[model samples]
Target: MSDSMVPRKPPSKGFAKKKKNIILLSMLAPGAIWLILLRYLPMFGIVIAFQKFTIYTKNPTLLNNIIHSDWVGFKNFGFLFTTSDSWKMIRNTVGYNALWIVLGTVIAVSFAIMLSLLTKKFVAKAYQTLMFFPYFLSWVVASYFLMAFLDPTYGLINHLQKQWGIEATQWYFVSKPWPILLTVAYLWKNIGYSTVLYLAAITGIDTSQYEAASIDGANKKQQIRYITIPHLKTMIIILFIMSVGRIVNSDFGLFYQVPQNNGPLFPATQVLDTYVYRAFMATNNPGMSTAASLLQNVVGFFCVITANSIVRRIDEESSLF
Candidate 1:
């Protein structure tokens, strides 16, 4: 047909809207599917926490198996609380995380501020690279690195002590110093990542704020107090809230591998995760293990909610929700 001989048709609004909706849905599909598969689907296993689950089930379906399993009300949870080590583990977990949150925030923010103050980009990059290197190392590898310095007989610290005519101390068997050692190790591994996060936030701050402060005759510390810190407040609060959520969780490797699972160090190093792992391994009790995990998750959920609520009351815009 010749041009203009045929009637021109307009685009349908309904089809256009449908096409746009399809594109939006397509963009959201992967994340939605991932959430369903990894998060929502696994939640079904929470029932196992309340059930006396067995491996010898004849049922082919998971739901059927759960239906057949004996339901024990809160016995599994009660078992965890009745143990002598329960309070100890809970104390260690919360204590270590509390210290970590405080120290990590301070150190990360300080390092980030230092990084922001650097005029030489290359020097700053080098320092940042060095700081971040330890974070990439696995806990197993980090443990060995620690052992090299801490091992009593032929370790570097012992060798140095020998040269200095001081007695070599057995580190792994000693519980007294482990709290400090573990805290240091945790800080060494985590500070880099935290610094990176804070640095990004700092970098996002308006340079004009600092310039204005400088024009007002503010010194470096004054500029930091008046301008930098106020800008970082939101990021700080968000990070703090997230950390609070994981108060019940601990670095299994840090508590386990780094200490080499030494019985003597259990007093200082045995956090909730490590305790649960050892208990589950020794007893082969899925119900107890699942119950422990469920408790941790529930506590963590409430912690996040509580932290967010507090922040919302103080500054609604800064709250995660």
Candidate 2:
């Protein structure tokens, strides 16, 4: 065939560029609007942190609040830094989040591996559906479920204890055992979602690798160690990096609700979020809440950056940024 007879047409570069821009804009508009409305707009309220904000003040105006309100430069932050509970809040937030990261990864990765091994399609689907059902339930609802099991006077544990002729323990008021309980609770409530993610990652992996490993005399555990773990490394690092950002942030609902906000457990369970809530309620101090929120955001931002840096040093390709 003659080259001229092929009738090749030149690509419309400008048209393609315009089409690409239009598609990009269309895809981004909704998220951009949502971020502006939900995330950025409320950031204006952060001024309340630097000001002595009194909700009951008669003059109901942002300008008045900014002007008349005393400018306590870094005083609120000072309180966060210097207060006795400050260290505790920091410790609890970081501690729990760190625990969550480790335990969550272990359970999720392990469960995903087991889930990947299941050959029965129907059973796998059913099991995954069952495991994922709890993710749909709100933390508030889950809190009630937790209370039913852990309630001091009349709870599932107490009832079971009675049946076994043993004394029921007051779990709510008990703080010493809370770290373990909270960790397990966090894992139980959250692992399914992570497991699903990891399972998806596992499924994305080529099966030929497993078959090849088997032919090479790699046992199940060895196959997993050599191929599966190596393949999942990227996903794990990505997840770990993402989790580090929230290291300074606690699950408000999980800590607040599951514990039923029992005062006695405050020492053990009082995270930055719950502490902020209490401070907000006691004095109705918007400043404290704002300060806490700002601190969390700042700390989270720094933590993510630091984590990404670490990840980059270890594996540049897997680093989020």
Candidate 3:
């Protein structure tokens, strides 16, 4: 046969697979574009962290500010460590985060396990809804709700205390009591969300494993200790790794709005986040804020890496990486 009359071979299996993968990948394009626009693009402003960023009086665009600003290098970073309140801020931030991470995990996991034990589907759903409701409420709105119960005079707690002939506490102004108050607020607002996540993971577990354990004369506690918990090990490790990554960050609204920003409460609630906000507001310095934010992100990034490495070293199968 002549070259012009040669027949072409059919598409190979790999070629068909590649075509199918391309179509599937196209489905992710929208999410990829959104991330690039909102997350990745803004990372270009990280340069402002090194600059003493000030708007040019003649041409004050953000780009112009970045170009005209003086390079202060590590000086902006030094501000975080050099301030008199630096130790206090760092302590509060790390301490609160540590407490939340440990307590939140224990409480969320325990609650999730309890919720999974609910035999009635309707009751389980109702409990989930109640737990999840606070996650939807904005911090601004939640602050008002907290104020209603904690108000010194007419607040529900104070009113009850008065009725019982107890002293009324000015909750917002008392720094000593805020540790407990903030802990409660943090858990109340956060635990439900975490519980719902673990509950979902628990729901995926094979019920037959539990049935088998039960037939072997294992009690409910024993079943949970072995079958239920072992199945949840991977999920728990992943969540812990994610939580570890954010160890340097705090919920700004919880520290600020929950106590209504009373000066007296600053001793207990002046975390890095709130401190940075206060510093930026006091000096109107973008460079300072940018440096603080960059520091947090870098620390968080390393934290995640370190946590994953530790988990991988112990149990390769459970590591997030």
Model 3, 12-118: lDDT tens digits are 99999999999998998999999999999999999988988888999898888889999998888988998898999899999989899999989999999999999
**Better-scoring candidate (lDDT), 1 or 3:** 1
> Could you tell me which residue pairs clash in candidate 1?
none
| Separate clash counts for every candidate | 0, 0, 0
- TM-scores of the candidates are 0.94, 0.90, 0.94
lDDT of 2 at 288: 75
Score each candidate by Cα lDDT: 0.92, 0.86, 0.91
User: Please, what are the lDDT tens digits per residue for candidate 1 over residues 62-147?
Assistant: 77777778999778887778889889989999999999999999999999999989999999999999999999999999999999
- Per-residue error (Å), model 3, residue 217: 1.0
The reply for model 1, stretches above 4 Å from the true place, is 1-18, 57-64
For lDDT, the strongest prediction is 1
